[model samples]
Target chain A: GDSVTQKEGLVTLTEGLPVMLNCTYQTIYSNAFLFWYVHYLNESPRLLLKSSTDNKRTEHQGFHATLHKSSSSFHLQKSSAQLSDSALYYCALSDRYGSSGNKLIFGIGTLLSVKP
Target chain B: EAAVTQSPRNKVTVTGGNVTLSCRQTNSHNYMYWYRQDTGHGLRLIHYSYGAGNLQIGDVPDGYKATRTTQEDFFLLLELASPSQTSLYFCASSSNSQNTLYFGAGTRLSVL
Candidate 1:
């Protein structure tokens, strides 16, 4: 069984500040893909970043996440938070050995609020 | 611009009523999935299909039935809707089991 965990339920920050959303996972597959998805107020959730290679950092939309297999963590980070960065962030994990389809196991999500 | 469309943006149904949520993807993806988002559970997989006429039970498929009639169409059915089933439903499609998913805008279903 695969599972993902997002420690922060909510994080509030001021505009132009640094941001980090913790994400961790537990999986038995050797080739596991970790993903970060951002969901806006009225839009569908979209992929922000993903990584399968351990210790490699993936970056997109001013956000970065590094997959640390040793720790089973793929935490999302941003150098500077923008007002538009406010949204619900989800961390997911998928393995290459699923019998049916590539099903994602998601965390409880962290709501990011960037204020002016 | 991956296109995944879900019908009936908002739906209201009574307990024990029948409800169907339709999803269509123009991406020609080989996999489609149904997930429900709730306050504390995040997104839980309900059902998924690998191809036309193929169905697979997901993590939470006890109260849901799904059908994939074509490569582009996937349907989720709730034969007896319950108040516990009220949540935001999302439809997603991917080229394969190990690819990024494109999601629809989502459907808000309320079972009273």
Candidate 2:
């Protein structure tokens, strides 16, 4: 079975501070896709960044994540965080070869709180 | 842009009550899914369908039923709603089974 883990339950930081949210996964497939979905207070969850090739960094909206296949980790990072960047972030994995390859396995989301 | 709409932004029901949540996607996607979001649990798939008249069991399918009447419509049914079923439900659609998913605004269900 595939599973995702987000170790940080809450991350509070001041505006302009760097942001890093941890994400890891356990899957049997060698070629798996990792995704970062952002959810605002009242908005629908949307895709932020998706992994294409392993060990390559994917960036969107000032946020970037690098999928490290050797470590099975895809951590999201931002050099500077803004108040508007505060939201719930979910890390998900899709095993392209599994029976339920299309379905994503999500982690316990991390609540990012940015303060001025 | 792909649009996924879920009716009944909020719902309230009692134990042993019946409730149905509706979802519609105008993107003509072949795959639609129902997911529930809970504290400390992220989002768990309740049920999903690859096409009309097709059903696939998800990780948490107990105490719930789902129907896919058309490619654009999918419904989640709870015959005996309980307090444990109280959560934020989101419906999503993807062009393919394995692709970027577009989510709905979500429906908050409170079962007493």
Candidate 3:
């Protein structure tokens, strides 16, 4: 069984400040697909960023995360937080490769609060 | 826009009642999934189907039955629901290794 851990339950930050949410995963698979999904209040969780290549940074919508196989982590980071960035963030994992391996395992969500 | 739509945005039912949650995807994706989200807990996989007439048991399949009747429709059945099953349910679909999941608005179910 694969599991993802998002250590932050709530993160509050002033607008324009940098933001980073920690995510670490434990899985026996070597090529695990890592992802970040964002969910606004009353909305479904939407995919934000994802990467399967180790050490390659993947970025989307002003956020980025890199899969560090050596560290077994995929931490999401942003240089500056925006008011629109306030949402619930989740990290996820999938064992298989390509389109056929679509089963996903998700982590507990992190609630981000961006103060304007 | 890619969309996965779920029916019955909210539901209220008494214990021992029967409930069926429906999901439809327009992206023509091959994989469909059902998950439940609880307070302070991450989304838990309930069940998933790879294609029409195919179903796979997920991490939390207890008290739930799923059917994939066609490429576009997937349903979750809670026969004799209980209080513990009260939670937010979401349906999602993907185009195989796309890494991008299109999710439905979600359904809030309560069992008394």
Candidate 4:
């Protein structure tokens, strides 16, 4: 069984400060893909970033994450947090060729609150 | 942009009522999925389908059944809804098994 873990349920930060949301996963497959989805209020959740290459960084909309296979981690980070960045962040993992098809395992989401 | 549309943005039904959540994707994607979002649980997959007439059980398939009527449509059915089934439901579609998912606005279900 595969699983994803997002240690923080809620993270509050001041505007312009650095932002980091931790995400880790456990899977038996070697070819695993990690994804970050941002859900803003009153809108559908959209893909923010994704990576399958170990140690390579994937970024989108000022957010960046590097998939670290050695540590089984793919943490979302931003140099400066913005008020508009306040949203629910979800980390997901998928074993592209799993026996059960393309099933994605998701972690408990982290709600990022940026205070002005 | 990919479009995944879900009907009845909000729904309310009795505990023993039958409910069907509809989803239609215009992206022509081959993969469609149904997931429920709840506090502390993030998003749990209820079911998914790779194509028309295909269905796959997901991580949390209990009390739920899904059908893929066409390449662009998928439906989730809760034959006997319960209070525990109350949550925000999202329908998504992807071009392939290993591609990005386009999500619908979501359906808020309340079982009373």
By DockQ, who's the top model here? 3
Candidate 2 pairs with clashing backbones: none
| Stronger candidate by DockQ (1 vs 3) | 3
Chain A (candidate 1) TM-score to true chain A? 0.95
Which residues of candidate 2, in runs, are more than 4 Å off? A97-101
lDDT score of residue A55 within candidate 3: 92
RMSD of each: 1.5, 1.6, 1.2, 1.5
Q: Taking chain A of candidate 2, what TM-score results?
A: 0.95
Residue-level lDDT tens digits of model 1 in A33-115: 89999999999999998889889889998999999999999999999999999999999998864344778899999999999
Comparing candidate 1 with candidate 3, which one achieves the higher TM-score? Answer: 1
| Higher-ranked by lDDT: 2 or 3 | 2
The lDDT of each candidate is: 0.93, 0.94, 0.92, 0.93
Give a tens-digit lDDT track for model 2, residues B44-70.
999999899999999999999999999
The TM-score that candidate 1 achieves is 0.97
Query: TM-score per candidate, in order?
Result: 0.97, 0.97, 0.96, 0.97
Q: Which stretches of candidate 4 lie over 4 Å from their true place?
A: A97-100
Q: Model 1: which docking level applies?
A: medium
What's the chain B TM-score of candidate 4? 0.98
